[model samples]
Target: MKLLFLIVLMYMFDQHKGNRLSNNPRPFEDIKREISDYSEVAKKIINLAVYGKAQNRSYERLALFVDTIGPRLSGSKSLELAIQYMYKALKNDGLENVHLEQVKIPHWERGEESAVMVEPRNHSLAILGLGGSVATPPEGITAEVLVVTSFDELHQRAQEAQGKIVVYNQRYVNYGETVLYRGRGALEAAKVGAKAALIKSITPFSINSPHTGIQSYAVGVPKIPAACISLEDAELIARMSSWGSKVVVTLKMGAKTYPDADSFNTVAEIVGSKYPEQVVLVSGHLDSWDVGQGAMDDGGGAFISWEALSLIKDLGLRPKRTLRLVLWTGEEQGGIGAEQYYKLHKMNISNFDVVMESDEGTFMPSGLAFTGSDEARGIMKEIMKLLKPINITQLFGNGEGTDISYWMKAGVPGASLNDDITKYFWFHHSQGDTMTVQNPMEMNLCAAVWTVVSYVVADMEEKLPV
Candidate 1:
């Protein structure tokens, strides 16, 4: 009886393997037909977005917004004004369910600040104090400089770092890898008893300008003044130190941090025709660094999201799921507004069909970076084929934006616009982020791609599987 049972199990296993191989592959003709079905609607969306008044109108409005409000740092009066402006504009544009959700955000001011080389040479350096940094004493902190390329070098020469200002001369490899020094340089330096920390700006190329970003102090570590210096100055300091020169510097900052300020996450929606509760979200952050016009970093992103809705409405097209737009605040300091929204709306997360964000600059439409199940990926691949005419045929997997990351973690499908980010990091958080970097034709193309992808996904018959 045992031998007979073994023979039967072996036969069943072989048959199951053959069936799996045969059934796993989808037919080419079926995929082609699926793509063909959506081709007409895709052409309509693209034509409306590219040649319609919505794109040009959105560009003009974006110019007015950035010029009038300037840099909308979180907790500033400018950020509040920007939010109010969008609220009124969306309502006037005939969008439904426009409102602001309250959020408490961090407030840090960059007062008069300067850095000067006192020893080895007399040179004034360009600097921007990192957000959340503590103010230096009124007289400023003056000490010899210890230069290191990485945290490992700082640890190896820990004793020498004492009673000195550590300068991180780390070169920029990529934003993700090079930004480590800026984010944690202060904590690492403080752990070794350094008086202050100076980090080289995280950009591959620079023209004697410094880029500022947020930095955090680890618990139980002494807080120290931290700031970013120009790439040229960092390299000069490192070269001088290598020649056995005592590089001494004086740093002064009047940065101040106040209590949390009341802010809001601006929201609007175009109600779905069939499934009113089901949602498809498109978003961008409204707050920016205190420098520049914030055009590329988020102004373009925010305006394009709004344009997607405007184009759809003008074309009289409504998807099956509600299309929502969220302009997040306090994204520069961290994803404060987005995190709060996630916590408040987590119970209804299952109703979210898709969340898409365009934080990266909208130079041109390359494709989309999506994160979902294999079945959903196959569906999106077929959908993206409709966009091949505009050179947006690429579809990457496992990429999502910071604002909607919490929802993605909760099993919601997510996507982010993929563009030619060759020059994005160069002007991202610097004074160079103005409307000059934007081209009218490229911006319109980007909006068209965003609109078509969002509409098709929301109109699909079935939800994206978890």
Candidate 2:
């Protein structure tokens, strides 16, 4: 087999006609063999991160970070503190190019907010004012509730929504489908003169928790107070409305939008030996919703990214391409930080081989979801095979992350963590997104997978062709 591989290499060189190797496709078998050669290195990374000294290091780092910082909401003091803390930690870790790049980010604070059902009964309901929501009058808005299950129903009953608080009891279909209600419920309700908008939390299971997220108001449309209600309350309102009972609620929100504030994208890296300019980027957003410790939503993701760099540095493994760890800000606000970073660095987009993100929960590892050319996907398949030691060598399509989507859309290969996210939405953007939701063993496995994939890709013979 060695003689055959050598002969094949010589034949390829001869076909190149001179000194340079051909850019033509290599056999899938050859790629597999090349990737399999990293099995020993893969085992070393896994052992160190999962069973060796570094075990639970990421989780411990994340616990300290999350507990100390609390919640790193964009444009807040906590976010800035988190940025500074990460910068100092990265420098202390001895990673290269540790610094921050400034970004202008939105600032929306959810102040004291409350809701109470007054018509049918005097009952208080849990509420979390959506980000960027305008405040209600000091005394609050007390009006009849108009419950609608879907936008179609709301539009059909447009006349009924006037002088009322529009309550969207949209069923939980999926994040993409249901999140539309949370994001646009205010705008849609305002179109028909709703006094306020109350959207159901976007989750299949909710323990009376109201999930808060960013909501947008259209220009020329009257901005209305908007907030998210727990699933139980949403269902209660719907049930009352179904029985021809009148439900009236008083809503008061102190939500205020301040001027955009200064923030940063914290960065660190391990410079490559052979191709210093070329990069394999690993990242997760540092900013999160203000409701919880923000541990599950992205704290785990960010720390594991740092762990990948730490693991590589511990092993004294420098790849052919630089490995950069970017902790982005303003990711919850539609990925503003990452968008700015992309615009600033896109001139060298060709030098970026792959951008990896781990926004998904750091649950038990499953595999990866990737977006790239067929050739790149083929290469990734071979690389994943090395992870069989951890039993997480699977690859799906349409790799995505709000932070990395900009690069992926511009044709750069992108990869996002895929794990057991069955309970992700249950705590996302809510007070439930705390350290208790995260598991140390799961985090160790996630860090192992992240390190192995990133190191192998960075050290590979050639970039995964875009």
Candidate 3:
């Protein structure tokens, strides 16, 4: 009996891998029975997500949603509007336990801003007020502009930065590396007693649009106004410097911080049947920059997760563990929403079976990057076998999304949906970001992949390793 069972098991496994049984035609009923053994709930979830992507048209749906929500900057009225819309949308999806967790966010308003090179010919530079930046006085500051491409250069020329507006023209080879300038350029410049700082927009491609992100103020350094200039303008400044001409810039901005505003992390859940305590989390941010619609940055990520969860709910396939979707706010500003969510839910980290984040733009699915225990790694390989049909066949050992980083630090298994990001940095943090950037079929494919992974994680009885 044992030998016969082993042979039968090997045959079934081959069939699961799409091998036919000796070219013998089977009845439709027999085929269905065989396929059902591979987790019917997971299959249904993938189908429903694919259907949603088709019906709504991922790009159009994302544009309509982003265009309507507008810029959802943290602590802004628009952000408040976005939160309400998201809450309603989650409830409409019929997700149980849908609610918002309060997160206090610092309010910073970007008032009127203008920059011009007064000396070495009159040249107006496109500028974006960085979040949390101190505004120049009503009179503004007009001073010589010193250009430096890196922190190392600034350190070498500390004397030149005094009483000048240091322009950090650092280029980012990758979004992760380039983003460092946006977060810390001001502090680095201020240490040299620079009157102000201007950073080159962190983008690989741009016409004249400037990118705005958050900057940190160093303790004990005199707080100074800092802003970002369009890539074109930064290049112009560099050209002037190479010519040995002093570039004086006039900057006027009215940015100011207000009292903390009430924000939220939106959550929707489909409860599990057997092990309801275990949960699989998936989501993206609901916020965008104050510039163009943040379609690619995260708006695409938000709806896909929402619609994916909705698809699972519609399929009537309850897994063994719950699937939770989170729509985080303030991801663009500094991941404040993610930080708050982590703080509030860190204690419940053990309950999370697997956490998946999709901050990368909605492009075709490449695979997934995972970080977890050795056992979880082995299970993921098995899971990959199920995903091979959908073209997600690769797995990376060293990646997780920015939002899920907190969970990973707290010992929860985390992963990121790796997309074909060859073009992601071109429009990242720019006005060029919009829904049109994504292909519908590819987005649908991505949604399908997410559904498969999420469902399998939720259905499995054992918690993913590490």
Candidate 4:
């Protein structure tokens, strides 16, 4: 087999007239000569990068995906439809070994909800129940509002919060910090004897829009009604709190959790011709929030990845390593889809050479990141030479994406296509996370970067280090 592969490599090198090998009269000497033809191979890669820019397949496919799948909040009928849509699309893209990996997912439903500041100002406030938050009693809970700026302040001012709506007027900051308030603020508020809790929206900028994301209830603490108020309303409450004037708030949240449901991760693969055992994986989650058709949060991410692979297949550029794509389910609900997938296919991890993920909101392509050895970092840096035309030079030496972190932990070198995240947090986890958030030209440019880099990784002779 080794002898046959060497002979074929030599024959292809001679046929392509690579470097000095084409001029050599001796066949055996060409084998040694072709070994140093990395420059010729690099040139082909550069040409593909330029070609990718002209193909607008990614934008066309993204529009179609949004039109078909729509919003895909976890466990909703829309999410179920997304599974089917992605499965069919993968099969149509000429990917072999297409199948679903089953996963048990939680079914949290958003029901009726309403909020209003009953005193000082009698106007209804925009509100949405955070995912996993228990609903208020059918009659609802109305109490005085006791606002605090931070968790430390809440603990210090527990006297003011007694039997009142302890409104956490914490300002939104970076995702690493702001997300903590959304995830654990409710549980902390319940630790005290507050009637209920209302949180300021977890976004930096908004036009009277309430953002909702998942929150957890501690094991022994009493679970109370919690909802996010629009930034505009939150500021009003903050002002009233500063004056030491009594603030009354009425919160009616109607969210509930049903029994577990069944879902699947849609998997597709373009098989390798020479080294089929090695795999290069790329993916995005297919599920999104129920509100506003979830076009930016993930629909764009999934479609763009699919489009990149589709371009490679269309170009008839078969790789030496298998290129796999997974449209995942249940990412918004705390990485359930990724965890289930890792467990179901743990054995296959050994064969995975590299895995790339794109979960960031659609923005102009800034660059790529890596989570592997220094050798792999050097290889990625070299590969970027081919991608320089696409404006994708920013590289992180030790970075991993949320969805593919499982693979990286298991030793599969992982990378994420880093998009411009400057404004991502504004609409993330909110009703504003729609397709309208994207600029079509920017999306296409990002897809072009993915196409070139992914193709090079697939076709390269050496495996991604580490």
Relative to the true structure, how large is the alpha-carbon lDDT of every model?
A: 0.88, 0.92, 0.80, 0.76
Q: What is the C-alpha lDDT profile of model 4 across 1-466, one tens digit per residue?
A: 9999999999987443311122323443342343334345444434443344434456567767777767788888888877887788778777789899889787988798998788877979898888888888888888988888899999898777778888888866677797777788788888878878788888888889888878888889988877888888888988987897777878888888998789998888888877677778888888887777777878777877786677677667777788888888888888889888888777877677788888886688777878887666766766665555555677866557778888888878888877788888778778788767877777766766666667677776556655
- In candidate 3, which residue pairs clash? 373-466, 376-465
Tell me the tens digit of each residue's lDDT in model 2 across 1-466.
Answer: 9999999999875543311123665677886888889999999999999999999999999999999999888899999999999999999999999999999999988888999999898989999999899999999999999999999999999999999999999989999988999999999999999999999999999889999999999989999999999999999999999999999999999988899999999999999877788889999999999989999889999999999999999998999789999999999999999999999999998788899999989999899899998888989988888899889999999889999999999989999999999999999999999999999999999999899999999988777876
The segments of candidate 1 whose C-alpha lies over 4 angstroms from its true place after superposition are 1-35
Residue 199 lDDT, candidate 2, scale 0-100: 96
Candidate 1 lDDT tens digits, 1-466: 9999999999886543312123444455664575578788888877776775554766788899999999999899999999999999999999989999999999999899999999988999899999999999999999999999999999999999998999999978999899999999999999999999999999988898899999999889999999999999999999999999999999999999999999999999989877778889999999999999999989998988998888888888888789999999999888999999999999988788889999998887788899997767877888888887777878897658989999999888899988889999888788988998887778888888888888887776555555
Where does candidate 3 have its weakest 10-residue lDDT segment?
Answer: 15-24
1 or 2, which is superior by lDDT?
Answer: 2
For residue 158, model 1's alpha carbon misses the true position, in angstroms, by 1.0
Q: Can you rank all candidates by lDDT, best first?
A: 2, 1, 3, 4
Lowest-lDDT window of 10 residues in candidate 1?
15-24
Report the Cα RMSD per candidate. Answer: 7.5, 4.7, 7.8, 6.2
- lDDT at position 250, candidate 1: 99
Please give the lDDT score for candidate 4: 0.76
Candidates 2 and 4 compared: the better one by lDDT is: 2
Cα lDDT tens digits for candidate 3, 420-453: 8888877776677876687777777777777777
TM-scores for all predictions: 0.92, 0.95, 0.89, 0.88
Clashing pairs in 2: none
- lDDT top scorer: 2
What is residue 294's positional error in candidate 4, in angstroms?
A: 1.3
